[model samples]
Target: MSQHAVLDNNTHRDLRVRIEPNADLGDAIMSCVTVPAEFRQVQAHFPILFHKNQANGAFNAIALFGFENGENLFLEGGKWDALYRPLALSIQPFLIGRSADGDGPGQVHIDMDHARTGDANGVRLFDEGGQATPYLEDIASRLGLLDAGYRASEAFFAALRQHELLEPLTLEIELDDGAKRSLVGFHIIDEERLRALDAATLGELHEAGYLMPIFMALASLSHITELVARKNRREAHG
Candidate 1:
């Protein structure tokens, strides 16, 4: 369970957190929720997919890291092997918290029980003068980016669904040893449908600032091939 509390310098002055990428720090994730605003960066490293929310019937964009659960191929030798790590993963053990009525600016909340928290040799969140450190400032900036991106993603997905651009994705992989794997219950943008969109509809999507992200998501599918290569390499070494 998570022990969440509003971050305060006076209450948690000596707190330090591990910021490195490692499985021990809960970095062994196969996928994470992403936003349309991050597609440009995320596309360069990972495959992007959409997942449907069964309860609300909404769609959430995701960045795929591995073929199996809890397998992050990008993590090796205590380092992330990518130029751009998703903002969602960079902000660890901390999340944006809203007020009781959920009608105000967000606050930074920390999960005290997380593996990244309470490390003796980790980065300090505040200075002796009770001012925020550079590390904490960076985290706050990332939290802002994530929160804004999350809100914008709603409209982006709404546009995709409105135009019927999403289609069920069926991905299958074969390893060097002849083992087979498959990804289920994920969706991808339908290129054919996108190409068939009328001029007026394309204009609508463009004006709404969602067209580039659509293409970015399509381009990101190429990274799936690279992920398979990484998996094969890991298996060979084992």
Candidate 2:
């Protein structure tokens, strides 16, 4: 359950949010939606994949954190091992909420029931002068980026589909002990198709600002080997 309320300095003056990396704060997911704007940074730390939304039939880019449900390999000892975390995960406990009429500008909404809220030693949301603290300001900025990125993602996915660049991905992993695990229901960029594109098509994609992210997503696949290594170490320790 969640209790959401529009953030106000007067009402939430003493509210402090714990910003540490922890699984209890709802970071235990195997993956989360990502955006093209984050692919450059996210690709360095996690594999970028595409997931088809069953309800909407839309494709969303995701940052893969684990191979199975309820697993996040990057999270260990209450700390995220990656050098960069995706904006979707970092902007937790706070979301941009539209007004009642739905035509007004977005407002910052905090989840009051979140584990990060009301921590005694957490970062303050407001200062003594009833002003938003630096922490809240940063969250607001990230929220803006996430909002804009989501909007831009539609064009990105359309470009991929128009060019038929997405392909199903099947991962068959063999652990050190000869145990096999298979992960399905994910899609990735088709490098062959990308390379086969004509100069005119490539130019169009470059002009539209989707080329870099495509390459970044391709580069991110290398990190899958690292994820397997992490899984091996964890199981060996156990």
RMSD, each candidate, Å? 0.8, 1.3
lDDT, each prediction? 0.94, 0.93
Task: Give the clashing pairs for model 1.
Answer: none
Off by over 4 Å in 1: none
Of candidate 2, the 10-residue stretch with the lowest lDDT total is 98-107
Q: Judged by lDDT, which candidate is best? A: 1
- Model 2, residue pairs in steric clash: none
Model 1: how far residue 94 lies from native, Å: 0.8
What are the per-residue Cα lDDT tens digits for candidate 1 across 1-238?
A: 8999999999988899999999989889999988899899999999999999889999999999998999999998899999988988999989999988878899999999999999998999999998999999999999999999998888888889888999999888899999999999999999999999999999999998999999999999999999999999989998
Measured by TM-score, the strongest candidate is: 1
How does candidate 1 fare on TM-score? 0.98
Query: Please, what are the lDDT tens digits per residue for candidate 2 over residues 18-128?
Result: 999888878889999899998999999999999988898799999999988989999988898989888988988899899677677889999999998899989999999
Q: Estimated TM-score per prediction?
A: 0.98, 0.96
